[model samples]
Structures are given as structure tokens and as C-alpha cells.
Target: MLTHKGDKSGIRSDFISDYDDLADQWWDPRGPLAPLGWIARARAGFIPVAGHEQARLLDIACGGGLFGPHAAGKGYRVFGVDLSEMSLREALRHGFDEVVRADIARLPFDDESFDVVTAGQCLEHVPDPFGVVAEACRVLRPGGTLVVDTIADTKVARLVSITLAENVPLPGRPPRGTHDHRLFVNRERLTGVAREHGVELELLGLRPRLREMARYAAGRLEEVRMVRTKSTSVLYLGVGIKK
Candidate 1:
């Protein structure tokens, strides 16, 4: 049986509720969560999974199990954790190896238990991102990989990703307030937090392909690409290696 520890004290109940409400749509490639699938693919590309086929991966906030299947296909023994039972059910339906409903800030795992830990598009929704990172580090073994991706904390990011992409009411767009500008974490802040946990951080920016963006707006999932860019002013992916 999967162990679930910790209360939801440090978590944002509203955020969990929001995700639970959308749990059914999470796996819909042509739905509001299309961007998340693309983001998960891009984030997975950055992790150096070669020569570690037996490695164990823990995906925090693994809503609908987007990244879990991808990681599992790459031969990692994958486990996912989230706070929403509805979301966990969705993830399980997608055939993830293991899905547990638990708080990210208080992960139920032994120290140095995982070879890879990921928190994609999750930090922004949590009330305590630093606490989540600390727990991720605690669960990661020495030299393990830690992957995270989030909207950058910047004016352009607010204008493009949140205000426009989420609230503009375009086709396939997410609901309003899907993101809170104030909770967005920038590269510097995330790196600092990772460093505090004895992990060296590297930042990578994800730039949307205009054509792909248009296809996404039209609810088409084909050839959706979010490639690396020189600027992380909008969306960014980070990699950390535990020491």
C-alpha cells in the first residue's frame, strides 16, 4: 500500500479544489491542459536519463499522470504523488505505476529514496514552494536529478502566459485565475532554493512555436513544440543535481 502522510495545512486548498474540478480534462490532449502535455514533454527531454534504466522517479503534483507515463516509457520505475484524490484517480486511469494522494510539502518517503524527482508546473500552485523543494531534496538520493518547470515571475510572463493565455477566453484556453502572478517563481529564486538544499541548478527557457501555439488555440495537439530559448522571461525549466 502507498503511504500518505501530512495534513494539508501548508497547501492551498483552493488550488487543490481547482485541479480536482478539472481532473477529468487533464488527459484531454485537445483540452485546456494541452499546454501541460507539451510542457511535460519538453521538461522530460532535459533530464539525463541515459544509463539509468532502473532508476526510480518520483513525480510530485503529477496531475493526471502526464509525465509519469513518459518517464515510465523511458524505463524508470515511476511513482506519482498529489493532494487531490480526484486527480490521483485520473493519473491511475492513465496507467501510471503508482499514484498516491499526498501533500507535496510533507512527502511520505524515506531520505534518499529516489533517483529522480520532478515538480512540473506545480510550485506556483503550492503555498510553500520552498518547503516542496526541500522535501524533494530530502527524498532524492545523492547525485539524483531534480526537474522543475514553471512560469517565470516577470511582467512579460504575466502579460503573455497568465493574462492572455489563461484569461483571454481563446479556444482551448484554461479558466481564468489558472495562474496567480504573485505566486510565479523566477529562475533566480528557484535556483537559490535548490542551492540551499545542496543541489546545483541549471535553467532553461521554453519558447513557444507560434504555429504550434495557433494549433493549440484551435485545439489540435499535433506537432506542438515548446523549444529552448535564450530568454526565460515567460516559461522556464530547471534541472538540479543533488550533491
Candidate 2:
């Protein structure tokens, strides 16, 4: 859930700073960013076994490394990158082989430096998610996988991801100012950008499992599973392979 430092939104610097404050709770299933862990599990399905030995995977905006565990046992030398030093430290302890403090839009790695790249749940916080997508593709070798998930720009998305998600009084609910609707992602533009970068992205919707959500609200479950759907109008994911 890291935000851009050069964000034109003028509202995400505070959001980025919030990561420091919440760093200790990143792995807590009952913590504010618990949804990230749930989505990471779903994202794992798209990540194939390492194609060869010593494969490398880069996790952009790898706040707290929720995906690290899922990435394990698959053989990738997982590298995490993010703007929050505190979050990077947390990620380092959570199975990531290494971590880098950097912005997602401008990766410091050389082209074709990675076998896989993932940007999860952070694009909606950036002013230029498409540029970040290009950077992701640039670092991925041909035939490498690219996976990303984000909140959509639709009005329904604003209502659900921001208006309800941040405002609802449920356990582990994010702070009221956690998201900026103006920075929500456009699915069409996201797919187009990936295509231009040689990755043919296939978009899919993600939604909380209702019965599990009710259990989570009632304290019966520590987390809720995000199921895939045909629609990409709200919370959605994009997965593809670089050509």
C-alpha cells in the first residue's frame, strides 16, 4: 500500500508516511492491511513455478512483503522494493531475499533484470500507474510473468473501495484518509499500457467472499478471501506474460 513520492495528488505523502506508523502491523491478519495478504494469495495462482534455477522476482511497492510467503516454495529469489524504509525492513524479515527502497514508477534495475514482476494494490495510489506498468515490463525478461491488482476508477469503485472500505467501522478497516479517489486506476488504460510494453494483460475482477466477510466482521475469521470475477469494474487484477 505504498504511495508515490512525486505524486501530483498532494494527498499521498501522508499516506506514504502512514506506512511507518503501521509497519509493525503489516503481518497481523487483524491489522489494517490484512486485505493485501488475502489478495496476495489469489495473485499467487498466476505465478508459475520458476522456469529455471535461481529465477528472480521483483515485487514493486512490496509494503510489508505480504506476498513473500506465497512466493516462497516456488523457487524465486524474491526482491522487494518500496518507498517506506520501515515497510522494507518488515518485508526483509518476511521471506523476501532482499529489499530496495525506491519508487515503483522509476525502477533502478537494468532492463530485463527480472523473471517476474508484480505490483499489487499500489497502483491506485499512484498518479501515473501506467508509467509504473511500463517500468515493470521493462525489467521483466521476455516470457516473464507480470501481475498487478488495483482499484478501478469507476464510480462504483469509488463507493466501494474508498467510501465504504475506509469509512466502514469494521475491524482492521483502513483509516479514513487512506485512499484518494482521484488516483483510482482505469482498467482499459492499464491493459493498454501493458500491451504497449509487450505484455498482453488479462484483467479480472476481485471481490471479498461475502460469507467470509461476514465472519470477519463477526470476529469468527481473521481474514477474508478475495474471489475472482468476470468484471473488472471495481477491485481488479491484471496478469500477463512479457512477449
Candidate 3:
């Protein structure tokens, strides 16, 4: 995790600015601002197994508290954290149980502070992913769960991923390259990193279909419209248990 202090918090500062600008839209569940339905879908894949209501959960890089209420409403004790103060403020405005402004790479929590630690789409933007993962591990109790969802890396899917991402009408979402160039990883690489951190893999799957590429080319996009093209551009969703 990169620690940002003083006048320069580095890349995190820049990313926070982007998130802050989109805070209001990000929290809204309706319209283009809502999370691509795939997020709720992906979270569902693990939430059942993770035991939402009884769990002590942390939503790392939870901009505008998008996923927190869903989990909180389910009965989990949710704490949302982000580098953007504006995002946190908006989260608090909506009555989030607790919201903190902290970089995910360097979480300020004590060891084993949470039962489930999640970083959805937030990993790729960090300067030190290994450190961020380590921090997630640090805060999770032994046998706790770690959930991650990020863009997948597949050679066959790259071209289609870029083309569709550019054409898609996602809200609050900018063009592919406008944000920092992303870091894409396959499941083996992801599981390897989790293994290095002593977390056991529980589940891994693509939420949106890989063949959605053909739908875009065939102009039958709505047939797969419910599928999240953004996360499905190849999404890597997994739950790892810390041993």
C-alpha cells in the first residue's frame, strides 16, 4: 500500500478527485449512475456464502457507499472507506453506519478488524496491489473471507473488450483510457497472489457471459443488456478464505 502524506498523496489523490466529482451520481441506484447490475450480481455470488447479516464487513474503496447499504440492509455491520472525502461525506449523508477516509493500500484499521474485506473494481487503480491485498489480509481475521471483482485479462477478449467499453452508455463511466491504464489479471495470477497472502480460494467465475462479444457485433446488445458489459468485458469474481 502506498502511503500518501503532505502535499502529495500521489496517484490516490488524483483518483479521489475523479471519484469525488461523481459522488452524487455514484450513490444513486437509478439511471446511468447505478452500478452496472453485475456488481450486485457478483456480490450475490459470494454474499450467501460470506453470511452477510452476521458478518463484520468492510467495503474498501467504497466510493459513495454504493455497495454498503445493500450489505447493511442485509444486516451486516458495514464500514465504507475511500480516499475521497466527498465520497465519504455523501455516504454519511445517506446514513451509512460508519464511513472513513483512508487509502485502501494502507488501511488504518487494527489487525483482524473485519470478518469480510472486499475490494470491488478498486484493486487495479492502486499503485501497490500486493500491499493493498496484504492490508486486506491484515484486517481480516483468520478464516475470514476476501472478495474481489475486477476486469479480466483474456487475449481473445481484449479487442472486443475495448470496442464495447468505448461504445457502451455506462453512467459516470469514462472511456477506457481516460482513467489510469488498468491492470488486468487472469485467475491463476489472482489466486497465486492470494496464495502468497495465505488466503484460500473459494469461488471464481465470470458474471457476464464471454459470448457477449458476439451480441455486440450482431447488434443484439439488449439480449445481453442485463449482463454488465463493463465488468463482463471479462470480470474476475472470487472469494478467498484467510487461513
Candidate 4:
């Protein structure tokens, strides 16, 4: 797990390799796996924003092709892109329409190639989030949707170093091999970047209904503790649109 961030280290490439290595075990939803549940939940959050079956879609950092193929199943023409061939192969195995090897900084597609573009759990690992968003904007049609989900920079996220990501094992993930980042996006940062990139930002709040109760309780009441724990600890999702 190469956690070292470097201009020369092919960090993206290495990250892809790491996921590719775990591709087979990546999608299984039943395990005590942290990433699987998160991915599924993120995909569910994305579907409503993704629009209908007729839309042509591109999923960046598609990993094992979670949302893309599911969208394809719903009647969209879906293309998935990732930095790892190994992960793309798993996506192909699951019947994604197209899987390409590319970087989000510079997508290998013509302008306005997709009606909707989605990225799940990838932004945090990306070195240049603005660059990635710019490419997503460039490749989407004027009214296309860009949906993204990433690890939020909450106090809980700080504890990520000690807490096994609900998906990572008890042994903890190799440093830099998993979430390799110092900062995760907050709503303000996401909005700022989207504005800079010529996109309309929408902060799609993702906390479950119970989470509100929890925030009300933390250190104050026991019932509230449940809600606070889930709310603060849960991954946040946001959506931005290309106008």
C-alpha cells in the first residue's frame, strides 16, 4: 500500500492496483466489509440524481463498476473509467457496457460525451479534485448531472487512522494504500471548487433520518448517542451539475 504522495510515484496507478487486487472481494455486500456497504449506500444515493434510463453515462473511478452497470441495467448506455485495469476487468465481468482505462484529470472522450457522469468514493483518493471535476464538466452535456460521494472531513474521519474502516480488516489498511489523503471535502470546499469549475453545486445531504436524533444526544443523552454516532460517522454525498 503506497501511501506516499508524489508527482512521480504514479499514486493514481498504485491506488488502482490496490483496488484491483481486492476487486473480487470488493462487491460482496454481506460481509462486515466497510467499503461494500458504503459503496452500495452511495450508489443508492446517486440513482435519484442520475436521472433516467435513456441517459448516456460515464462513471469515473468506477472501481468494480457499482453504479454504472446498475444504471446500464436500468437502460442507460454506461461507460466506466478507472486507473486500474484489474478493477475494470471485474466491472467487465459484471457486464458494464464499456470500461476504459483513463485518468479523470484528462478523460479520453469528446466534449459532451455523456448525459450524466458519476464518481463514487473516488474523490478523496484523487490528488487533484478540481482537475477531476473539470474533466467531468467538460465531458458532460450542458444539463448533465455529476454525482459524487467521498469521505467527509468530520472529527470521525480523523479517527480513521485507528478505526478500521467498516470495510477494512481489524489489522487496519496499509497507510497510503487505502484512503491516502490528509483532507476530505466539506460542503464549502465542494461548492467553492464547483463554482471555480463552472458547475452548479448542490450539497445533497446524506444523513439518515435517525442521525439527527443522534446529534441531539451526543454526551447529552443515550438515545441521542446512537444518532450522533451514525450521523457524524457516516460518509457524506454531494451532487454538482454542469449548466
> Residue 155 error for model 2, in Å?
0.4
Error of 3 at 136 (Å): 0.8
Clashes of each: 0, 0, 1, 6
lDDT measured at residue 218 in model 3 versus the true structure, 0 to 100 = 58
What is the per-residue lDDT of model 2 for residues 69-116, given as tens digits with 9 covering 90 to 100? 999999999999998899899999988999999888899999999999
Off by over 4 Å in 2: 1-18
RMSD of 1: 4.7
Choose 1 or 3, whichever is better by TM-score.
Answer: 1
Q: TM-score of the candidate numbered 4? A: 0.72
- TM-scores, all candidates, are 0.88, 0.94, 0.72, 0.72
lDDT of 3: 0.62
Residue pairs clashing in model 2 are none
lDDT, candidates in the order shown: 0.79, 0.88, 0.62, 0.61
Candidate 1 per-residue lDDT, tens place, 184-211, comes to 7867777888898988888878977888
Judging by lDDT, tell me the better candidate of 2 and 4. Answer: 2
Candidate 1 stretches with Cα past 4 Å from truth are: 1-17, 50-54, 218-223
Model 3 alpha-carbon drift over 4 Å, by segment = 1-17, 28-33, 48-55, 93-95, 169-182, 208-233
Query: Which pairs in model 1 have colliding backbones?
Result: none
